[model samples]
Target: MKKSLPKYFRRFLLACAILLALFGLSRLYFRLTDDFRLSNITYKMPYRQAWEVPEMSEAQRENFNEILNQKFYYVGKGAQSYAFKSEDDKYILKFFKFKHLKPSFFVDLLPSVGAFKIYKEKQVERKNRLLNSVFDGYRLAYAIHGDETGLIYIHLNKSHELNKVVTVHDKIGLVRHIDLDEVPFILQEKAKTTRTVMTELMNNQDISMVQKRIKQIFDLYLLEYSKGIYDRDHGVMHNTGFVGDKPIHLDVGKLTEDDRIKSKEFYKPDLLRIVSKFNIWFKANYPQDYPTLKAFMDEQMQLIFEDERV
Candidate 1:
């Protein structure tokens, strides 16, 4: 009996060892074969060198002018900006000057700093694509080319005046005209006015108007956050305003992905703060509108939280 007990114990030990080995082998296989590329793909700037504006070939120059001529509306300039219409007539372009590239001495770090601006452009592209897919009629705004330099020539025939058609200032670059009346109100302003305008709109009491605007604004931010867009210095909530009865999103530079997704500082706290302030402001100024806006925000946040879970 004792000898048979030892044999059975040996068999049990051997079976356990085989099972663990098989499990480890399966895990290793998956670790190697699964879609790990996304995890490994780090965004590093090309090692060649710092980007310099490439000289335009003759063909490239012609194509560039053709693209500009075919698309774009000319909006009037602000102190440091020149606006244009996007090809689709759905977005406005704000070109920044070289002087606007002042470094943030405190937070500027490597890898992230080099990738920041480009990441922002990519983020806008992702958000626009996602929103346009999820919301049937919604079209999120986008930033066009970040930086390009070249000599621009204007041909004014007898029918058109060069000055009236296009204004070419050395410092400001070229300003071309296209239809932009339908653009969101927020897109037309400097960054400083974004929060104030949003707060004012939230405080308006008209139920129908509040509902429409709140939906637009909420969708706008949802699109922004889902695409992993975050601007550390500016703190998300870029620009806002209405286009007709609907709200619009604008000024989407400085967006990027970060490890802070797990931190409350990233989304929850900031979102709560924005909503709380908005509610307070709404209650004080337009007591009648406060409930509608509050309800809209509550529903929107619920949707956001569900999406985050998935």
Candidate 2:
């Protein structure tokens, strides 16, 4: 014979069952929504239960991991990172490898279950706060910021043309299109770096063209400077190249001071030296383009001087 449970006792048992069922469903939902590539990341590298790789599509992350394994030609290196041009040159993968995640702050504090609790509490913060800040600066550099692991994918230049489009994903998993001002700032490190720049490469075949563009870009910088922004990094000047007559600034990370920087001096003698060297090269190598190039330089200088006077 079964003993009948009291009414209050039955209610308590039923409530426990309902809560357990809801918890189970919530776990399942998390599993379903989670980006699967994160599992691959865990397998290849040490997993930080705190940080996660946002899921794009099912196979996108998997294919990206595979690309990392494949052989790629070395393109060049900026200050803090290396650039690898993919086999077909369809995309250039800029990778900044980071040290493995440290022991969580919770572990330092509690030495026991604190990491577990902190991980749960910070999961939302990691997903929301960290991602929000990165997405806001997507325009500063039109490259996708993967997790702290340090891999950035940039679209390759196809034609010498303006209005060329590139694809980058925002924090909310939507596609954002941007132009290739040779959009710079690929993999940004948290630490500060020396703002060292390379000297002029005399042996470069198109040195004359580069000089003209440099002078023009320098003028453009003055124009952009008036609006309260650093025009371009002095470091990657050599790497800057053209797509349909437009100069693409590659390294965008170098700053005058802080991210909200105020001013930097734009000197003329330094710029003139560059243009003069190029003038010699253009007359010797690219004579036909030299006349128009100087004309263009003169015109840009006119605009810059005019704006300065106003």
Candidate 3:
């Protein structure tokens, strides 16, 4: 017992040392990468010292206006973002809504930094320019007037042909799978309050289609997230849309939690949540086919609830 106590104490001290080192590095990164001085300014969140985006020049404003004035097809929205693409087929845009944030936002965001605390909130307006640039399909964002942050990406106008829509549900395999508009109402509103907005995404046909798309999504998801080059908030139905059969990411944000699925932590729980979504989705969309979906969903639910011992 005496020896064990000494060993445990050493392990605790080591853990503390690592945490302190990380804390120091995070602070350094925050101080060095702080772009408040370099970027333009916009309206701050409801109550905070100053978390804002850089100001857009007159030219950027004109581009913004040109895009806004024209009509476009709605892609979908994520927790705090809404997306659309122009009719002329040039780019896709995503708008991020930043709600409540603290002054130490940066310190609270960026992994090595305030990750110890949850104060960062959205950190939306943070230089997403650097972040979006790191990935191929991801486009950089710009601060519009003051309402929200805008992200513009190269548009792939393939899904434009999908006129018939079906909501795909993986609800415990009873019924089946199957598969929106407006700055548009979707099948469901994820969050009711202003803190988070509902998200929607475009997909073709039904459950089978989403299943096929899953393999592709997994491929791309593994590619980007594995390297830690991109902070994929973990993909979801609404966070991804189809452009001529290709999956496109609809939302952009930072996930600083080191223990997240894509991070060091196991990703199964996150994937299981999606599976559960399939259950609820199936129950809602295809009641007749739901019983058929039970076994498949049951297997998944088993992994989620029963397989933990493995």
Candidate 4:
């Protein structure tokens, strides 16, 4: 305060302050009005029947129904969904996040200048596109790679008939009673992430056993590639998981049906993107095992690239 700032600098600071205040107020308003009940959700699988998968037999339906009746423990939340693991540890239910479903009414209040309107329209379009993409991806995964994806069922609308409820115990020790009848969720077979599984294997199992498991995961990836299914989200670590000995794509939202992914040129780079990170981590943490595993992986990759069967 000893020396006053220049006029333009002061103006810029004042503008920044105003913007910050507006942002704070907007956040507060959203927090205050946050509706946990999700009563105002707009999309509801409009034309499609709620349960359209005719492939599910009566026994499978009964099994799913029995599982739904049990209480579930809360798993971590992601950008798109809030995940919960079943009491029996056999299933996972991912309820779509409220933030993704909620409408942004502020966009409606903006004046309709040509550029502004177009901008707002594009935002809305993008939001819808993301929502649709996730739903469509799940459906496609279930249809094409159900075993690999562990996708059991997709519930896209509110219904009293289902009346599925769960008791969730979160990380903070808070208990939440949620009615799945109101929540849009995907039911899937439970799995541990690839990173977690791999770490445990490295710590507990012999190098040969670890190599076998890793090769199985690579084979699974190659199989999916052969089927023309590609996971847009690098399906190596977080997005991929192990259900027993089989590696499955856990994050099904970003899967895309691209035949080009079958080509070795496109596949190698995608494979390396995650493996290169692992290679560095292995060298630093378990230096003795690194060279052996690295050479093994290189040989396997070369074999994969050379094999015309994909």
TM-score of each: 0.39, 0.34, 0.37, 0.77
Instruction: Please report how far candidate 2 places residue 251 from its true position, in Å.
Output: 2.4
The sequence of per-residue lDDT tens digits that candidate 1 reaches over residues 1-310 is 4445587899999999999999999898655433121112112222221112344577855654454454445444443234555454544444432122223223234244556756655554664443223211111122211211011221111111111222222222334232222111122321223345555555453466555655655565554455554433233233455444444444333334444543544777656655675677667877776777788777777776665531
User: Candidates ranked by TM-score, best first?
Assistant: 4, 1, 3, 2
Q: What TM-score does prediction 3 earn?
A: 0.37
Quality of model 4 by C-alpha lDDT:
0.75
- Those runs of model 1 whose alpha carbons end farther than 4 Å from true positions after fitting are 1-67, 70-80, 84-91, 102-206, 232-238, 241-248, 259-266, 306-310
Report the number of clashing residue pairs per model: 5, 1, 33, 0
Question: What is the C-alpha local distance difference test score of each model?
Answer: 0.42, 0.41, 0.38, 0.75
Query: Which model scores highest in lDDT?
Result: 4
Query: lDDT at 146 for candidate 3?
Result: 12
* Candidate 3 per-residue lDDT over residues 73-181, each given as its tens digit: 4444444433344556555543332222223455544563465344343444443433232222222212211111124322211123222222211112122111111
Clashing pairs in 1: 73-85, 73-177, 73-178, 74-177, 74-178
Better of 1 and 4 by lDDT: 4
Better of 2 and 4 by lDDT: 4
- Which scores greater on TM-score, model 1 or model 3? 1
Q: Which predicted model would earn the best TM-score?
A: 4
Model 3 clashing-pair count: 33
What are the runs in model 2 whose C-alpha is more than 4 Å off? 1-71, 76-81, 95-227, 231-237, 243-246, 257-284, 287-291, 307-310
lDDT of 4 by residue, 126-201 (tens): 7777877777778778888999988888766566666556676654555767776666778999998877877887
Worst 10 residues of 1 by lDDT: 148-157
